[model samples]
Target chain A: MAGSGSDDDAFVFPVRTHFHAMARRPGGIPREQAIEAAESHLHELHHEFKEWLDQELAEIAKILPQSADEVTSDDPWVEAAHARCQAVRDTAATMGFYLVTFAANNLCEAFDTIRSGIEYPLDAIDRDFKTLLLARQEADSADRTRLQELIRRMENPSAALPPAARRTPSK
Target chain B: MTRENLNLHGINFLVADANAYFCMISQSILRSFGATKIYEARNAMDVRRALVEQRIDFLLCDSMLPPSGGLELTRTIRWSANSEYRTIPILILTSDTRLNTIAMARDSGANMVVAKPVSVSGLYNRIAWVAFHPRSFVDSPTYFGPDRRFKIEGFPTGVGRRKGDKEFSVGEEDGPALAQDDIDSLLNLARKA
Candidate 1:
């Protein structure tokens, strides 16, 4: 079920395949099998990550939304969404989709903490779920701008990143 | 928004900066603009490491690559490096706009030079225009814009009137546009992305 569920995620976030295709372009990829190179690698990513995300999605779909208007505070689906996004983010980072990986990491830090925390009582699970949904929605709303910035940087190295948000990896 | 690494293999964009919010927003926008992969590299050394490690299609370089000036770095890449790595198009953004400095920048091998501080909208269009329409663009010319000491108008042949239409066509003297390939690179880089 999880395997099939990630297909939905694969459909929405297709970074893995995009990266694979680029890597295989030139100065990369094996000498042999260059013939079917593009197709095979891209397809492989779609199958692996997307399928896993699809499964995660299926879990969310199953758990959340008791009825169109009846998603209660205790909805288990919200937790699933948070977890799925966490895993997806980790996977996206490995594949080289900067924005997706960053976003996924964002989701993990935001939702996963609350999900795992003992601070939120069992009775108030609804509040936690609401917070998760709200945060996710905010990120979703900003997706267009975020991704556009990502594209600009992709096209040219000299494009500026907002100075306030820039980070340096440690030595 | 936070992005995650996926299992699939493909292109990744790397943002080389130390500011966190700046990285987040820029990385996010880059994707919306059409990049599938994005990475972050802060400072000059990070940029070098990223270039060596990843198959970066694009880079978001800070004009202020601490310790060393970004302008100087562009010059090194242009003059010293071999073609394979040198092929990457670098867009240099500088805060100061001294005419002489801009001229030196052109010679340094920067594909395009943008004045800073750039508005987000301007940044978006500039990167998209250059990255998406690469073939149409070429090298940025050694333009020495207006300054008291050195200016395009100060040229021996009153080139002030040579701006806009007066310069390119001159009443149907149909030769190659501008007679300089570098200017074409600027026009193309600044063209609609």
Candidate 2:
């Protein structure tokens, strides 16, 4: 609704309250009460994130090729997969799922690189998606350490990546 | 030791989140904190309508609303000609972790920028901090809303200052803080025509 105006609507929404006559809230919320209130909301979001991740993973699986060499930037499948990766990146970042967000970001970048005719190793793309899935599963299981490791791997996958996964897909 | 419970007995809140789940979460949390009236808006348009119809005490807005999103919303409210709407505290909630994104939130006149999935403790902490330590809003030619700069530990020379640089700590010259009377009158002024 933000851009709904004609670019010159000086006044859109207006309210006339006796602001000077109204009493402000008593004071700042106590720390304990604040935490208790926040926990309830965050708990719901945590479960919601888990459910969203599951759905995203299922969607990702349907689009992934059996082999990295099958990737084609112009292919509709590639575009769909890239779009999914972007959505995952945005949503996962919101939930503070570090590994998933990072991997998804790289996955988008890899797709972009491929689209630009760069020969980024297709195996790297495959591994990135695999890493993202692993992170999602680990997050579901509350494996915080593994999530951190996946984040590290996403930051520098080539260092710990197996030799086979470092190979480029044949054009 | 003294303990005080957070009491939102009569507070009215407007939550603007594009996601239905997020709206539910924010509303639930606000209720827990003792808010008596909580309004939900799924997009920028609804947000405007809610503002027009309700006497909101606080606002929790998502940065990814639709069409224009929270950034634009913040600008609209902050620059509104109406004093009652302009001074209402706004919290920009989003998942954007990029520094530039946070900077954009600050530039948009948000009272605070909070990252999601926001936890109970994090949300409360920000609310309490903002409530008790409200920053002086500045309406400059190029900027509006709460002052963006805050002091950081060990940054003695101030932001971007070298160790030998002679600039005093930023904000030291603001003098004694504005009195309640001064603040009230200052906030009542319109920044734009």
Candidate 3:
């Protein structure tokens, strides 16, 4: 424990320097060698990563509403989907799947906007979900870029529409 | 001032996350750093159990841990008057690196916020930094954790706002201000020390 006085009293506790001694002990592996070993382990886990990603996508699909009519502005499913996407985003990048991470991050943002009371387009959500699936299937960077551009447009449809055809009125 | 390679052997680490894959990945990274003992926790209950059973040297927690988030767990640990684990080094792992999110993690008593998907080098450096540079814990009325301020060059007005802060007078300048390169070199020296 850091301190031993009353809760109301402000105090400063000294640093614990034991870790320094532990880290500096002899016979430790070299930094580069340890990193190389870890990278090898991650490579071995790549197959498992695909299986994990598949399970995560399936869970997201199961939790999200099937149709726009089924979703309300404050639907709890939206939050659930957001959390699932966040998990995917956090893991995909570490597994060397940057495109999947990007698509998942996009969906996470859309859910965040929806949760904040904005009326996000359900079609955009569907497209992002599809993009995630496609990104997992396709490894081409050009295709990934194209899919990301499409999702960006879907995220903000009014940006693609002309001034006279905008959906929400500009302030 | 030379840095030594980190040896995490014999250190007990607790990795808490709702996602099992994330926990596995974190474990892999820690193992790469020579960690031999690691525990996994999926929720608050698991975390509490692990804290009670193990003498955890480090904690890597997901920002959105289930059934009451990681921040809540951190606050509970920090506010617990009698808990021996109150001052454990907590590193929050999350993909959300927005400014507000980082600020919230800091306010919740975490020592560091690591953005995901975590790279091997990034994780290694963060762990080494925390181990090498231990911060003094500050016990205040509204806060109980590592001191939020990283550096204390001086307050803006040569005074602090805290109740116990002391007022100091600025000394008259005796020489010309150092050049930018000179300042940078000085800081680099200090960091190396």
- Among these predictions, the greatest TM-score belongs to 3
Where does candidate 3 stray beyond 4 Å?
A1-9, A17-20, A69-73, A139-171, B151-193
Per-residue lDDT tens digits of candidate 1, residues B61-160?
Answer: 5555554767666655544435344545566655436565565555555555666444433454454334323322122233211111211222112211
Worst 10 residues of 1 chain A by lDDT: A5-14
Badly placed stretches (over 4 Å) of model 1 are A1-171, B1-11, B18-20, B81-83, B132-193
In the range A34-99, model 3's lDDT, one tens digit per residue, is 788888888789788888889988998898677774344578688778888988887887766677
- Residue by residue across B7-117, what tens digits does model 2's lDDT show? 566667888886665677677677766666889998999988888888787889988777698999899888875656786778998766567677778778887888865
The regions of model 2 sitting more than 4 angstroms off are: A1-29, A44-49, A57-126, A139-171, B1-5, B152-193
When 2 and 3 are scored with TM-score, the better candidate is 3
- Give lDDT: candidate 2, residue A148: 79
- Which candidate number maximizes DockQ? 3
- lDDT of each residue in A80-153, candidate 1, tens digit only: 66645554453444333445555455444545445544233333333433433443343345555676675466
Superior by DockQ: candidate 1 or candidate 3: 3
Candidate no. 3 TM-score: 0.76
Residue A157, model 3, lDDT: 68
Error of 2 at B4 (Å): 5.8
Candidate 1 lDDT: 0.45
Give lDDT: candidate 2, residue A31: 56
